[model samples]
Target: MTSKKLQVIATDKAPAAIGPYSQAIKVGDLLFTSGQIPLDASGQLVEGGIEEQTHQVFRNLQAVLEEAGVTLNNVVKATVFMKDMNQFAIVNGIYSSYFGDHKPARSAVEVARLPKDVLVEIELIASTVVE
Candidate 1:
């Protein structure tokens, strides 16, 4: 049996992993990203409302995906965690704007809290190459 190789992907464009984790891990052709909050590259949380925070989260996600040799278009699945469920529609709008026509499988849930008290966090699983 052939064993798969796990590769850690890191980039200076995105906020560095704050804890004990890689920004993303690539196994074979798949890339799994850690949950991205609204933190900037300096580890400072972006100051703004939901829409702005969403943008920061996507920016971070894009950075990590790029480091893994992929783009948001390659995402096959996504998970969103929010501090409040009442903001679902707003978050959905921003998310749709980012993804455009590429609809990936997703799940969004309201969590008790998130790192840095941000309004939203996002994570993704994607292919290393666009199909």
Candidate 2:
């Protein structure tokens, strides 16, 4: 058996990984992205409520996806974590706006806390081989 080399994806447009992890990883046609918080490229968490934070999270995800040569449209799966489930509507609205008509499989849950104590975080799995 042979091992397949995975490609590490990164971009200055997105916040640098906070720990020892790549922004995303690609193997073959699949790209797995790390959970993105509301931090900007400088690694400072954005201001405002869940709506604003959700938007920032999506922005970070977009940058990572673009770096991988994909977009939200190429995402096949997603995972969402929010500090409060009460923010679902706000987060969902922003999420729908970003994803548009392309709905990917998803799982969402309210977590007690998140990195940087941001209100929301999102991660995705996308296909780089867009058909």
Instruction: Point to the candidate with the largest TM-score.
Output: 1
User: What is the per-residue lDDT of model 2 for residues 41-117, given as tens digits with 9 covering 90 to 100?
Assistant: 89988889888888888889999998888889999999999999987988888889998999999999999999888
Candidate 2 lDDT for residue 12: 97
**Residues 9-104, candidate 1, lDDT per residue (tens digit)?**
999999998899999999988999999999998889888899999999999999999887788899999999999999999999999999999999
Model 2, C-alpha of 104: deviation from truth (Å): 0.4
- For residue 2, give model 2's deviation from the true position in Å: 6.2
User: What residue pairs clash in candidate 1, if any at all?
Assistant: none
Error of 2 at 29 (Å): 0.9
Cα TM-score per model: 0.97, 0.96
**lDDT per prediction?**
0.93, 0.92
Question: lDDT: which candidate is best?
Answer: 1
